[model samples]
Target: MTHRLPVRVYYEDTDMGGIVYYANYLKYIERSRSTLVGELGLDQKKMKDEDAIVFVVVRVEADYLRPARLDDELEIVTTHHAASPMRWVFDQDVMRGDELLFRAKVTAVCMTTEGKPVRLPAELRAKLT
Candidate 1:
């Protein structure tokens, strides 16, 4: 199943053309990822300070199809492409109603506080099921 997050485009998220600023799409995607982790009872700050591990984006590939305007109510769809002990790959799409504005294949690696890749924690990995 895909995780869906509701996003409302604000004026600050827009460009001079009044459409969403290009870079803000990345913000939307990251927010959904953070929410997904939170929903699974994983807190990045607590995990990092306590367990000494965190998740970091290792790769990002995106496609921009259409423009999302200010005040548009959109849905960010995130689906797990691969959820493993070492890393998680998510296929995410940003949409306004039935219209797709952008899509991305984002890869995040489980890492140590010092920035080396690490294995995913057992309980956290189970949530991908």
Candidate 2:
């Protein structure tokens, strides 16, 4: 399944050239992932508090395909791609209408507050798959 969320480019998200900053694409995907997980019934805050587990991004591979300008209406689409016992990988994309602006493969690992890796909860994995 794919989860999508709309984002409008603000002045702050643009560079001096008025194009969306390179780094902001990461932020957009982050928000999209959060919403996707939440929609799957995984409450991050609750997981941290109750399960003592937190998800941390360990890797990201992205490509900038096209440029998005200020006030552009963009959509972020996120989908679960793969997972192991302790890590998950998601594929995400940012688009403006039919044009693909950016895409990324994000990998996150479950860890304890103390920083030790932990196994991902079965429920969360099931939901993602």
Candidate 3:
């Protein structure tokens, strides 16, 4: 399944050239990933507090294909699958209408609050796959 989130660029998101700053694309996709987790019935805070498990980004590979300007309406599209017992991989895109502006592959792993790697909870693993 793919999750979609709508975002609007503001003055703060732009650079001196009036286009989005390159790093902001990562923020956009991160929000979409958070939203996806919520929509999937997973409560991150609960997981961390009750189960002592938290998710952390292990890697990100991104490509910028186009620029987004202030006031532009953009959509973030995200899809995910399990990479292993401890890791989940997400493929994401930043789009303006039908135009693809950016794409990324993000890898995340489940970890204990003390920073030790841990296997994903069975419930989350099932949801991700």
Candidate whose TM-score is highest: 3
Q: Per-residue CA lDDT of candidate 3, range 1-129, in tens?
A: 799999999999999999999999999999999999999899999999999999999999999999999999999999899988988999999999999999999999999999999998898888766
Rank list by lDDT: 3, 2, 1
Q: Which window of ten consecutive residues has the lowest lDDT sum in model 3?
A: 120-129
| lDDT at 102, model 3 | 100
- When 1 and 3 are scored with TM-score, the better candidate is 3
Model 2: residue 15 alpha-carbon error in angstroms? 0.9
Estimate the overall C-alpha local distance difference test score of candidate 2.
Answer: 0.90
Q: Each prediction's Cα lDDT score?
A: 0.90, 0.90, 0.95
lDDT of 1 at 76: 98
RMSD per prediction, one decimal?
1.1, 1.1, 0.9
TM-score of 3: 0.96
Candidate 1 lDDT by residue in tens digits, 3-112: 99999999999999999999999999999989988887888899899989888898999999999999999999999844667888999999999999999999998888
Best by lDDT: 3
State how far residue 56 of model 1 sits from its true place (Å): 0.6
Q: Cα lDDT of model 1 overall?
A: 0.90
Give the Å error, residue 47, model 1.
0.7
